[model samples]
Target: MPRQKNAFAHKKNTNENNQNKNSYQKKPEVIQEQPEPFEDLIPRIERLEAKFDEFDSSILEVRKRMEQYAKEREEEKRQEELERVEAEKAEKAAEEAAEEARIAAEKAAEKEANKESQKENEGSKENQAPEKNSKDSNKNKNSNNSAKPFNNSNKNNKNKKRYK
Candidate 1:
């Protein structure tokens, strides 16, 4: 029994020590130093790096195209702005022209009304001249003629005798 107990105690202690050893042991990162110098490796590195340079150049070209597209869009916007201004100017000019035409028409209408009023005044003067002359001649003729008596009383006496 004592021998078995010592063996079992030895086994437990060995298992505990193994667990502690496993817990204490950290994994080391591997870093390999190349024998070649940076200068000696440049040509080979350049060969691989040329491929990345080509991809970078393609990306730069895409960026340049995008810039050009943005420039064209800005130019289109500028052209639209200019056109809008021109259209507004033309609209204003057209409205001004219409207003001018209306003013001219009003002036012409006023001139015609004045002419018609003058013609009416002249015509009324001419008509009054003829009527005034005729009235003066009639008044002179009446003053020259003798006063005439009415024969209505003689006609009434004759009509009474005939009825009787």
Candidate 2:
């Protein structure tokens, strides 16, 4: 009977040891490992942020310069267009003035020619009046001689010399 009791006790002890070994093989609570934060890493991140800010400022400055250049080019184009228009207007005015002057000069020359023709007509009339008077005097002398007998004025002169 004593031998049976001791054998039972040894079996129970063996079972307990097997259960402890199985529990040790697996962890009851899991431990998570985290990396430690370093002081140097913070400064590196700050430097990267500063470089991004600088790049943004440079892009803004480039945009502003491009806008200024566009405005200047537009102003120059407008000025050139205005100058071309002014030149065209001035040329048209000059042509109009020259045409007016030519018309006035032609009118003056025509008037002078008319005056000269009128003067020539008056001179011809004066010459005709003198010719008419001379022809009338010759007709009167021819009629008086025809009315008397043909006598020589030399016979009268001979009689006058005998009397003296």
CA lDDT of every candidate: 0.89, 0.85
Which 10 consecutive residues of model 1 have the lowest summed lDDT? 1-10
Give the candidate number with the greatest lDDT.
1
Question: For residues 1-164, what per-residue lDDT tens digits would candidate 1 score against the true structure?
Answer: 45444546657778778878898687776889866668778888898899889999999999999999999999999999999999999999999999999999999999999999999999998887555558878888887895776769989999999999
Please provide, for model 2 over 45-69, each residue's C-alpha lDDT reduced to its tens digit, 9 standing for 90 to 100.
8999899999899989999999999
Model 1 TM-score, all chains together:
0.48
**Which pairs clash (backbone N, Cα, C closer than 3 Å) in model 2?**
none
